[model samples]
Target chain A: MNNSEISEQGKLTIVGTGPGTDQLLAPAAKQALLEADSVIGYKTYVDLIRHILPESCDIQAYGMRQEVERSRAAAALALEGKKVCIVSGGDAGVFSIAGPVLEVISEEDLEKLNLSIIPGITSALSSAALLGAPLIHDFAVISLSDLLTPTELIEKRLSLAAEGDFVVVLYNPASKKRTELIKKCAQIMIEAGRKDTPVGIVRHGFRADQNVTVTTVSEMLNHDIDMNTTVVIGNSRTYRKGRFMVTPRGYAL
Target chain B: MNNSEISEQGKLTIVGTGPGTDQLLAPAAKQALLEADSVIGYKTYVDLIRHILPESCDIQAYGMRQEVERSRAAAALALEGKKVCIVSGGDAGVFSIAGPVLEVISEEDLEKLNLSIIPGITSALSSAALLGAPLIHDFAVISLSDLLTPTELIEKRLSLAAEGDFVVVLYNPASKKRTELIKKCAQIMIEAGRKDTPVGIVRHGFRADQNVTVTTVSEMLNHDIDMNTTVVIGNSRTYRKGRFMVTPRGYAL
Candidate 1:
């Protein structure tokens, strides 16, 4: 269906905001937000795009861990004949709100509601662009958040990605309760013969307060990483040239 | 450096055109392309955005396998005091032209040239949006192209991703000479105990002729897949609820 063809009835639109920067937001997402009768999202995410939203749009902001409630509210609003938009900070498909929104919708509601997902540039893509092409080859994106996933599973995935020599993008690498996961991730890569492999750590990538640093698996522990940081651990072929971290696309050069 | 601060000197800008759809392209990328003195990209990619480009902008289209030459030509034009925009079909950082552009830039040229990468929605994200929220958890993106990477290495990575229960997004799964690799990947996943996992195959995801299919790992080999298809193999938790393929975010609901 044409994304521009808005239905006469109320609909539920899922918008990927693309790394919290206005310039980074896709035209499709921007259009969805502009046309939304109501916008439901995390408090921080809503604030990121608050200025661009129309005054007629009803804004509901929820604190952290209220994802289910927010999605339910959005769906309920749509059921009431309102054009509702559920916004995600990154691509809704990747570790974002799309799953929760889908989970809250019932089978009976599916036929009545017009649901559309507007794609956005994920945080991995945003951070990778800033670090110059560290993800030019095969890669794995694993979040270190133990709140939802078990730490054992996270460690297992890290080891496997390192062993397979896939470039790895680690999200939520550290938090108040999970400071050691990044260190553990680095140790796994080091043990897998990637001690000297380049690692690009980007904080608030593409934003005004963005910070980027290039380090190695062995020295990653020395850097200051937190939940806001997006870490890219390069494969064996990834290297640092000047300030940029690059992984070749494996052309026969 | 602020991305908005454009220097008076000619510069090289790498633009991600976002899955060959105008609505999917980021505002930053569109702005860069509109202001460019010339645009260089693959013939197919150039044709995708021909109508939107400015009349004064010189367009150079190259055939396949000329990525190196295209990047070089764009860089040379930028060095000759022309604003050059090198376009890639999807996100320039993912299996696209960003790496080659970075590779050909010399140290001396770096000081004089302004290089910026405008991120776009990759095909994986586009396909995931079309299929539903199949990538809400940790995932791995592996290109099955054996042209640059060894088939043995691709097989190893596929096995590791399956063993770790990571959702996998396979790019370039099949071509004229690479028909058997997708089948081999399915075998590895089945051997790793994901025989009943859900699989989503999306072709030309966000384009006019987009097609999305949701099936099980056992039934995947029965579908018609090719280089144009982006295959998503779900983890153990992934399931099909009606037409949508969803992987839960593991919330304690």
Candidate 2:
């Protein structure tokens, strides 16, 4: 059946593929992709899930930093009575496409589009799984990409997270042009008296090329990390146990 | 082949079942449960996945607050050459079983047993998806269950998170015994100038009886919330767009 004949309103599924791993992908997300008439996402994310797309499904791939455009295009397609899926690497609700999609669609359009967000294993949780449990206690997640947010605001959040003794998860820590933000973040944590806190750097988490490195806040700069890495700085009670980096849950036992 | 004949070292898999929904369960977690010789978890979580367990697998169920005992029993079973799976609701790494499992096992035991953690959709992400993208910006996750964490510490973290303008996700917000904690949390947020901030309360998140309510910080206490609910309080820029609660990602556009 064609789009118009099948239903009056086409559905829009925002799918989070979960750290680019098939095993980590929720069953609902996989089912949504299979049922989608078209899949739209960043080129890199599209490549990650290319194998799973149905042969008849249309593919619309964009380059990085085209999130807004991609979301709008997906919404437009959905409004045209086509079942569309906008893909994100981790949980779509976490610094991903879900926000932008919601932002662009008006209230009337949203009601007509039949939108649903399928959650996935975010990088923070996936990285924590690989590095023991650094998120066992209260934690904060901050993105260091100053292109959208001001550097001063990022710095302020970092200092407050450190001061609050949160196990801070740093996303988009460093890119080609933003190479020094991670260092500044580490400096803020060091100044907040977490100089010796345990930190785990996980690159390409849950992928074949995954790399896990354990270091201290003061020594974080010595590692080779980039935008692909998720850096987890431990709280005051975080420690090293054998090869694992662990932050104890606040339990009396 | 029997466990001893197949391999000398038994396997232990810590699985996150993801908000009590089978569709939300990761494929890896489902596979791990099916392949296990025995499955162990809190009674509630074990019940959540009982239908998916293999017929041959033994099930060990424990009462609430038996996390340490459950992990120890699971570890001991693994040491005896049984493939064991310990389950947790939501992501095991986030305020869940991964920490206790790692803490209970010794270095030698860890090396002797094959251990793996399969990530799942955490309540924070699932709740965020259901409430729209309140987590698109920097966020903090704090558990208000002061049973383990002192009330003073939770208060301090709440104050700092508010001061930093971080989107906050509150887990274990209220229970029958802890009826007043959630009220105190709202008061702190209000005092920090977030009196009108958007708050989303998600109960039974992905389950059949799931409930979602959107309210302001000042009116949060008027809603029906319990420990099963995950509360998300928006930052300064959070707003109600239609039925969805959204927090902007700070894009320049």
Candidate 3:
């Protein structure tokens, strides 16, 4: 291997899988994965990009609810002069392990460690493309995973996004028992803005189900969407053109 | 050739140049461009990506302000059974030609045409990455380009963004003679929130002379920034940690 490759040998490269599609992975992400001595990530995330990983490279599996431990372990491995690829779904920097890994590295006081982040497609934008461009305008992405915050705060943010006339992309909109939060979000939005505003439901994003349904806030309120669904609420200018959901990006043609 | 490849031959692929770095370009985008029989974009955009253009490629050059014409030409070229690639800097879908191209294609009654928009790094994301992470939370992106729209609309968006307390990214903030728009944006933000809200200014985002400066809104009011600069205004939660500008996405460990 050359010097750049050799320099990368003992370092850590965090790659974003971009919502689980091999096509959505960035070039830098693929290169970093190709150069990795070993790759580690959540089970599903690892499976998402296994096609491009080196045949002989070892894979470390971290089951669900083990993210913090996995990040710390990956950083510790990198400190031993072994190339480690810490992988994440969606953009690594957004609601992913890049922060936790970086935090662990800093806590260990590992100085001058060569590291890089490979950007991936965020599920929001990728889904935005699949749905007919509800993100064509000024938008806001807020994850409703109040696992870290209270539900009250999430409700406040939803209201603020609606009040601001932002095309809102809601990540982690629903889980097995979390339909109420999304319902609350829709209610808050309706209260803050007009009720007939368009809302898009992108199921499985760029992956299999990939069901893009553009409905109004009232329509969204009457449904139950799964965890794989991303709920996009359009701003004031959003309109339905046939089955397509379009939000004006404030650029006039 | 495979059926998809054969069908893809007559389709249009709009690849994002991705903040002007080969490293930042997604592999899917590069692959689409490499497989293109013809490439169509602005002269400057073409120059930036000429090294990757295929030997068999036909390049149709459209100078500045000729975007709609160029887009129509690209669509027509594709409709005539040529694989066409429409290139744009940053993400093609973000403040760029992808929308215009799609608009023309749809408006001109080209319903049977297939189009794929591969997302790339937007300058807002790149600029945020250069600093610590200002976009860890939900944010708003507004382009102050009033070439086609009234300045009033842009201002209204800015006012809404400020009131939302979302971290704001200002694109096309100012031009040679339009230096006052950014000032107006800052003024709007100041009116909605604290005057000491931290503002991170990034010029030539992701490019070599990438200058990053963090100042309070009051300090920024006295400063001058141009269109090339991406102005990131922090929310109430934004704070400076050393030389980095960070917005807490949520409660941290």
Predicted structure with the largest TM-score when compared to the true one: 2
Indicate the worst ten consecutive residues by lDDT in candidate 2 chain B.
Answer: B1-10
Query: Arrange candidates by DockQ, highest first: which order?
Result: 2, 1, 3
Model 1, position A27: C-alpha lDDT score = 81
Q: TM-score per candidate, in order?
A: 0.96, 0.97, 0.86
Task: Please identify model 2 stretches exceeding 4 Å from their true place.
Answer: A1-6, B1-6
- In candidate 2, how many Å is residue A249 off? 1.7
Interface root-mean-square deviation for each candidate?
A: 1.1, 1.1, 3.0
Q: Can you tell me the CAPRI class of model 2?
A: high
Fraction of native Cα contacts kept in each candidate? 0.84, 0.83, 0.28
lDDT of 3 by residue, A34-105 (tens): 988889999989998888888988899788767668877787778777888989887776666765665545
TM-score of chain A of 2: 0.96
Off by over 4 Å in 3: A1-10, A55-58, A65-67, A102-111, A192-194, A221-224, A249-253, B1-9, B107-110, B148-153, B190-198, B205-209, B212-224
| Backbone Cα, N, C clashes tallied per candidate | 0, 0, 0
Clashing pairs in 3: none
